[model samples]
Target: MNINKKTQTNDEGPEDSNVHGFTSESVVVSNRVPERSTKVASYLDCSVYARACGIETMRQWFDYHRVKEGGKPRPPGIPGDPSHQYREVWKGWPQFLGTNNVASAHLSDTAMSLTDAKAWFIKNEIQTVKQFRVLCTEGLRPPTIPACPEKFYNVKYSELLAPKSGRYLGFHEARNFVHSFEFNDYLEFRAYKRNNPEMFEKIPSSPDRVYMKSSPPEWTSWPDFLGYNRITRTRLEE
Candidate 1:
């Protein structure tokens, strides 16, 4: 019996080549895809998740916890009490809404104001004991919330494009909108401070300090409204 043998050849033409037909030396290149700017814009649009919670609230909560735990101490033992256990129970709560989860709801209910909530947090949670007295003298001032104009309320995309529209204001509008007295009962108190420097000074600087020191006068400006103190001053200064 004779067997037929076929010879191998390299004559595979373009049509008979791989799906993306190309010579061994001819490399096929594709253009790079552009980045999606829409997502960035959307993120920018939605950056104020916690702005509604107010700056004073944030500061007070920070101070309360900072003092209570001696500024970021390790978690307590498993059999800790309600206050200590609450810390571990919701360690990642603030990452979700950028505010203390355990305290946010409580603050909202009792204070009916984020700032007041923070104040209450400091009073009840931080300064409840005598060992935490150093926090009272830290001289950390609560940030003033900004005044969000009517433009902030208008949600039209076209309005966002406007130069002066609140949507375009970015962090300024978000931070201020949350901190302003418009969302709380302290509007009259805040306004009174703004109108009368001497009288405002007579009021305590911090709710904690009210029992300890004299208050400062209230002043209003785009800076105050946006909580644009020395730290945040540069964000919108230009």
Candidate 2:
């Protein structure tokens, strides 16, 4: 039989303590990779690295070494164009673009927050494109208005899917602020007590207080959200 013994230490903290004859303070960081001048690698899930290598920013190196020898450079999108090709691409662009932007915040060259990412979509005219797409999805043609200062706008897929992407707080955490309501839960609780006095202690607490102030989200009601296949909707043309 084996027994694990424990010891008492100073009041410092776990960071300052050593136990079971092991010490984290004794560890040292090292970069001693076995170096091979040119390492072979597979070309999958590494487009970003390939993209870096393909960049011809310096011009001369690209002009001399790399040419369009890799058979048409990249595969084409959907053969021929559809009216909603851009929309379809826009909806799935993130999936096609991979999770690179998701890691942009951690990259040294670029810094992006959720706010910055939202701003980028607006800056790149994606909101207008997304609104057009969503409108098309509803079989509604894009409206061409000369000028209406009060009614001009666009929508972004990211902002449309808020909460998940950090645009707005989801309702589960903000139900109390949306509205107020009255219920009969407490009445039922009282009736139960009167019917079974001996079981009063076994009765559960009334849920009336929990949803007394419950309400739906301030935004328009979400419809067919899951049915939309992850593509989102917005007030831009709803």
Q: Name the best candidate (by lDDT).
A: 1
Q: Which regions in candidate 1 have their CA more than 4 angstroms from the true location?
A: 1-78, 90-111, 117-238
Q: Per-residue lDDT tens digits of candidate 2, residues 23-134?
A: 3222111211112223322122112222322322212222323336432221122111122233322322112223332232333233344344444434434334445444
- Assess every candidate by TM-score: 0.16, 0.19
Which candidate gets the maximum TM-score versus the true structure?
A: 2
Per-residue CA lDDT of model 1 for 135-168, tens digit only, reads 3334332222111111222222221111222212
Error of 2 at 171 (Å): 19
Question: After superposition on all CA atoms, what RMSD does each candidate show versus the true structure?
Answer: 24.7, 24.0
